[model samples]
Target: MRADARKNYDHLLAVAREVFTEQGADASLRDIARRAEVGLGTLYRHFPTREALLEALLRSSFNALAARADELQTADDSAAALMLWLRETVAFTHENRGVIAPMVSAIEDHDCALHASCVTLRAAGAALLARAQADGNARADLDGSELFDLIAALAWLREQPSHAPRSDRIFGLIADVILVRHPRPEAPNASGHTGRQPKGRS
Candidate 1:
């Protein structure tokens, strides 16, 4: 694509994603073009159909998430990384509520799940889960898909205006259930303090 065409494509994508989130899968592509200050023909050129646009968007987001999982695998503390990643997943889901609803709705037909992109996402996320489990960090009982779906659900719930306060508690439950080791309760030290008590206390 030419420089201006590429710029228009990028702008249309950004606007479409935001509008879709606000107005759902039925959001008008024309309005997205308007927001992007581009022609309707330009939007159609970039994405021939609504489903094509949705698939492109989902693929883009998943690609970024897969890359982030690769980064987490490189970090020394795999458990901490997994935990942080879960929180980030929740936030992303919350922000992408409009995207999620339509994606789910599309899965009823045999034609759905046609993309191999979901497979790639699963592989990357599973690798991170495996690392965490191998490190004796995460509960072995929960497989990668289960853990991922659990977080995605939490993120879905997080999007509800009524559920904001429960977000922390929900994540807390995830930690409690998923973490294999609880920090040992502190023992009393020389000063007859519970180790949890300030070390400098008399």
Candidate 2:
């Protein structure tokens, strides 16, 4: 990394961050190069691929999130810690808009540039979930991978124009469902049954 080359890399990364924030993860690499006042070849030489560029951009944030998870492990309430981590994870994905697809893909693709970071993040969430489950706060049937999927689903909801406003509510609903202490009570039916009525009957 020569001085000039390093300067270009930094500038490109800064520009890419701006572009990605505005246009999302799938924003055009060519547009990023143009905004950075660099040639497309230069961008490719530095980033190689979209995943590589995203990996470089997200690595620090992912590391911070992993550290945060570790810190949360020592919290007094296991369920609260897990819920906090879940909220932060969902917020992180929402902040990085359009990244959920690549992240979900990266987890299973060992060769992907973002795979390691994604795996570490998932593991962090898993640890939190496991702690809660062990404390009898969270559901025992749920697993880390399922937790990751839930995060992805919530983040995806935040990405949609029609559903974004309801994302927070939906997230709360999900959190309630996951925590044993916060189970949703059955609604009373018209016939005074203390449960949901069958759809056709209703």
Candidate 3:
């Protein structure tokens, strides 16, 4: 690419990231061009579609996430490391609103520029999940693919107007189910009650 063309490309990417982070992956392409002080044709020349732009924006983040997963794989607590990575992934989705759909769609599209990055991200999480299960810190029945599905579902829920205001409580509920341990009954109190008294008698 010519020096001037490379400059435009860099500027467009920077502006697109800001616009998408603020207004989501579906933010106006024209706005991106205007913000970058470029023409719509130039934006299209660099990124033909919203998906293309989003794929470009997310490629770097996906690479970084995979790198983080690598570091976390060696952490002392496998389960904790997996949970931390999941939280980070959730934050990424939250910041890049309207991106989850395209990401999910692109994962299976070989032609999509984001496909390789998406697969790498999933593979990184899968390794962590396997490690946690092998260490007996997490349920063995669940797999990394299910974990990805769960994350995608949660992201979609968070993006919806009705669920936009949800908190960590929702994530806690799902994580509890996925990461539960054998429940030991509580010890009886002095009254020999296991906290099973009727509501009216309590």
User: In the order shown, what is each candidate's alpha-carbon RMSD?
Assistant: 6.2, 7.0, 5.0
What lDDT would candidate 1 get against the real structure?
Answer: 0.75
TM-score between candidate 2 and the true structure:
0.88
TM-score of 3: 0.83
How do the predictions measure up, each by TM-score?
Answer: 0.71, 0.88, 0.83
**Alpha carbon lDDT of each predicted model:** 0.75, 0.94, 0.86
Q: Give the Å error, residue 157, model 2.
A: 0.4
Model 1 residue 64 distance off true place after TM-score fit, in angstroms: 2.7
Candidate 1 positional error at 77, Å:
2.1
Ranking by lDDT: 2, 3, 1
Q: Write the per-residue lDDT of candidate 3 for residues 83-187, one digit (tens) a residue.
A: 999989988998889888888888789888777888888899999999988888788899877888888988888888888677477888787877746568989
In model 1, the clashing pairs are: none
Residue-level lDDT of model 2, residues 41-103, one tens digit each, is 999999999999999999999999999999999999999999999999899998998999999
> Model 3 — which ten-residue stretch has the worst lDDT?
174-183
What RMSD does model 1 have?
Answer: 6.2
In angstroms, give how far residue 53 of model 1 lies from its true place: 1.4
Per-residue lDDT, model 1, residue 173, is 83
- Stretches of model 3 off by over 4 angstroms after superposition: 182-202
Candidate 2, after superposition: displacement of residue 170 in Å?
1.0
